[model samples]
Target: MSRTQRVDRTAVRTRLDRVTDPELDRSITELEYIDEIEIEGESVAVSFTLPTAWCSPAFAWMMMTDARDAILEIPEITDVAVDLRDHMHAAEINEGVNERLSFDAVFDDADGDIEAVREELDEKARAARQYRAVSALLDGGATPEQIVGLVRKDLTIDSEGRTTVRLDETLSICIESEPIERYLEKATATGVANGTDAGLFVTPEGETISPSEFETVHRRGRLAATNMSGQGHVCANLAEARIGSASASD
Candidate 1:
């Protein structure tokens, strides 16, 4: 047996960084999730692990597919195999990879309309925003009974200094209380407590809340929990030191 030739594995690894984990929203390379990469002649084999075993199977499979596609694009790569280790549904993921690779052959007569696909995606985005608003309300102090009360009809509240919930066709639920900045602070804090990605940040347009704002709110929530909550307040003091160090950079 003869070894075909050794390829520059570093260059191939750099290309793999282009693949991203959709849920974590980070490049696989940054996450240090790639376990090993073996390049022999025209064949490439890669193994990786997910952050958790219970991560969304569809997302993990799609990411693996994308990663394989990216790697195969490297010159002289004729075959590729991506192994998902320690992730739930590894067998299903392997099946999906094979299916995706053979998709063209399986759907020889199928054709996609890019414009129609775009329109469908745009509609889904609107629906997703509405769903997020509903989920947030449900997850918050609001009860399931309260959610049932405000399902269809537009809901609004005018709480005197208390958090009020309002719903609009466009923005879905809008909680109005105090200034926007203060509300953002509270909301972001709530997000952090829930271990959610929600944050608070000012938008470039000076209107409409952005995802960054929710992240900030979540981080603050974590800080407040560590500081204000009894027994856990000690953690908040430690967090304060970290926050102070971070802010000092600014």
Candidate 2:
């Protein structure tokens, strides 16, 4: 039998608590979403369930990604695998976890400065590619509305057309787009129809609506859609702007 390092269950649990459930805006531990934690030698297996099955597949997977990162911080843990069996977006979670684990392994042995420099270069390269793509899309005669829609639906784009992003509790929107008033008006109409207050809010950057806010607007109508987004909107009113306000604090 291969010898294994002693894993500190408490430390692992504590680290897991740092990862928030993207939909609920609460720690997975507090939500009691994590179902099990199995330790087998150097490998750690985690099982979890989301608030709903149809919620944002990408966001759910992001949570799992965060969880995996947290677990891998434990020294004794050599292999960390996340299993989302009852999760709303199981496939996405599985795929995201695998990708994150692969990435983590790459940086696992790197020093802080090396990782930082590598990340900065990567970000710059990605930004350059994103700008080129957005320029191409605009050159192709894509309407502003179409560009906005693409930004709302696709996170890969980074340019003037992309207006929203989320980092922790903050949410922002783009203001550079012509007819800013019109976009807000559309957001207001969507909010009013959904019985929410202020459907959109400008981000700190003052250039885009936040991804979370965009998601809120996207999921304003229909129970089926709401269920797919997660349980956060259970009693939400899209006609008013309360949802936006509540989301800001979350």
Candidate 3:
């Protein structure tokens, strides 16, 4: 094989980073689920293991499809295979992806638009992101009404104050303002109304709510955040166990 035909590891990894786990809206790579990346002449094979063998077939298919699509984006690659390991539906998923079949084509009982699912997840992620920034502002002594009326320009993050929230060397995320950025990105991507009239926070339906309704919205957002956090904890544990077991067996 010519040197030019070899896969570019860095480019492939960067591409994979954009392919996220549908449920968590997080990169599979960041979750450390990618088990292998093999380059053979013009073909590149990517393999990943799930947190559990019985993980949702829908989510498994979503990741596999996204991964294969990402790899195909590189003009240099002519062929790619996405492999899902140790999962109950691995065979189905592998065949579905390798054959370029639709999700419903592989699963007989599947119904409704997959885009609906993606949109729902995107909304939840948007809410979760907004919750972080709002809570941060609240802790910094901003009022509910003030938050409800805020525009993007009204937002400001003081690095020192954010660092103070960490207060420990191990707390690396305290100073980062990704939540706000994520919220904005999701908002823009989904075409949710933003700016002075609608404020930084908007309903899942993409409409502006009154100041008096902020409490209810804020409380609901917190609950959504809690549920997402709990799910995240469960996934983290499963990933740890799966990764550990794989390592031991190796």
Candidate 4:
């Protein structure tokens, strides 16, 4: 066999950390879904298990593909093998993902295509992250009017991990960068805040939020955040039990 280029293990992990579970909108690495990472020269094999054997097949397919794609981003890594363990659709998902087949092609009975599912999840994630980001700004003494009026150009992030918000010609506020940065990432990706002149925040439907409706939109964002986190907590608990059971069997 031909030898492949050397790869950095830490760099691989960091890339994998960027791949999130679609439903939870959280990192798979943080969710403890990654069971093992094996490397041989430039190729990698990632083995992961979900909280349940019957977890949604579409969700599993998304994660497996995402994991493979993330690892391949490293220039040195030539190939990636994603192994989905102990799931009802593991066989189909693994085969489809490794072979680069479409999700619909592999699972003919799937009600909706993967991209639609992904878009929906992305919208939810954008909303949830927006809630936290807006909360951070509010706590930093920003008002609803100031926040709703923000545009892409009004925000700046520095190397020191601070986000400076230019409220007006004479006033600006600095806040921790993490929340705003995270929100901006999803917001930009979903095209909700894509242009320099576009509003920085919007309703989950991608409409500009009127000042009168800002409170309602914020509340919905909070609910979206709550639902995702609650689901994540349940998955975490179930995953723990599942892992423990496997260990005892061994």
Candidate 5:
């Protein structure tokens, strides 16, 4: 490959960072699942391993396919390959994902649709992120009523780390943008915050949050966040142990 044609390692890692472990709802890269990245001309290959050999095949499939798709999104890249290593079903996942086969086609005995599973996880992630966003707004002095009443048109997110939440015609407050931005990403994905009239924050079922139900709804969101965080810690410990075992064996 010529100088300009050389694929950037950082670019590939940046794209891979978007691929998250479904159960943990955390970036696979952040969890140190990425084992290697090899570039040959316009083709890039990624190898990853999970925290355990028996990690859910569905979750492994999702991460592998997502990583391949994310890397292919780069305009300069023409072909991408994902290799899932160390998992019990790694071979099936690797072949299925590379061949672009459906989950059912790959695993005929699988119970339900993988897309349905993905949607469920995405909703959970949205709820967890919603908790953080709402907490940020509350800490910024916005009331529960104002938050429940917010619509998609009420937020103004600028380039900086500040987001302006319009409580009403005359009252608006600024808060840190990270939480809101993260929430909006998943909210839009799960069809919670799409239109100007759509409620900016909603229940896990994607219903408008009433004032009376705000506390309960917020608590549910908090629980989702806590559950995800707890799973993340468990996965992190398992991954660390795997790494240590590998080092010891060497």
Candidate 6:
């Protein structure tokens, strides 16, 4: 019998939290897409489901690969196996991810490049994140100039336990941690600098969206957010139905 390294369930879940649906820009965990997780010896097994069997193979493949990569970060995990439960291309994706094949190698002559698709979605996510962060500041009475000037080190929990982010020592706005978490994750993925003084409202190219263009950027950001929200709701409903069907069958 192989001796297994002690596995922490919390740690495993924490790692998986980093994996997000490419289009939705939401955590697989938050999206309720991670169906199950099992561990044996140094091997980790994760079974996940998508919104539907017909979800885009490229996006589904990314989620699976991201999960496997995230789990492998644990020193105790020497192997990771991703099972795509009900996807149309589940078999192809599972095999491709396990074998570490490129998207083109997995789907030869496919219409789109996976990297390009990923970048497109990443830009949308960054726009959504920046809009949400800046909007929260606006709601809390921050001027447009102040919102644009905000930096990463501005995020902190205040004495009253509310999440607050600041543009300077005396200019802080109260907000929740969810949007901040969302922004930071996508910011890093989009090549934005992550540091205390790094600007919060940056374009996909890692350049700060100028205050003069704030209105246009905010409008575009809101649109991006609305599109993702609609997609997320559809996926959530489909996932619920799938889960219900599985339970009835069981």
Best by TM-score: 5
Candidate no. 4 TM-score: 0.95
lDDT of each residue in 54-94, candidate 3, tens digit only:
88888888788888888889888878998898898899999
Worst 10 residues of 4 by lDDT: 1-10
lDDT of 6 by residue, 1-250 (tens): 2664588777889998988898988889988788788988788899987878889999988898889999999988899999998778888999999989988998997788898999889989888887886677788788878877777777785555467766576666677666666677788887664776777777545577788977887888898899999999898888778767875755
What residue runs in model 3 are displaced by over 4 Å at the alpha carbon? Answer: 1-7, 136-143, 150-177, 193-199, 239-250
- Per-model RMSD to reference: 17.5, 18.0, 6.8, 1.9, 1.7, 3.5
lDDT winner between 4 and 6, please give it: 4
Residue by residue across 1-250, what tens digits does model 1's lDDT show?
Answer: 1545556788778878877554333467876668899887888888977655655565566578878888888777877888898666776676558566433343344355423433332233222223334345655554433443342123333455434453324344454333432334333322321223222222222233444454443344344333323422343354456445654654
Supply the TM-score for candidate 6.
0.83
The segments of candidate 6 whose C-alpha lies over 4 angstroms from its true place after superposition are 1-5, 151-178, 194-198, 203-207, 240-250
* lDDT against the true structure, each candidate: 0.52, 0.50, 0.75, 0.91, 0.91, 0.82
Candidate 2: tens digits of C-alpha lDDT, residues 177-205 = 32332233333333321233222232212
Best by lDDT: 4
* Runs with alpha carbons beyond 4 Å of true place in candidate 5: 247-250
In order of listing, the candidates' clash counts read 16, 32, 0, 0, 0, 0
lDDT of 4 by residue, 1-250 (tens): 3554467678889998999999999999998889899988878999998999988999999899999999999887889999999999899999999999999999999998789999999999999999999999999998898889999999999999999999878889999999999998899778887888899999989899998999999999999999999998898888788778886755
Question: How large an RMSD does model 1 have?
Answer: 17.5
Please estimate how well model 6 matches the true structure, expressed as its whole-model Cα lDDT.
Answer: 0.82
Q: Write the per-residue lDDT of candidate 5 for residues 112-183, one digit (tens) a residue.
A: 889999999999999999999999999999999999999999999999989999999899999989999999
Local error of candidate 3 at 195, Å? 9.0
Cα lDDT, model 6, residue 74:
95
Clashing pairs in 5: none
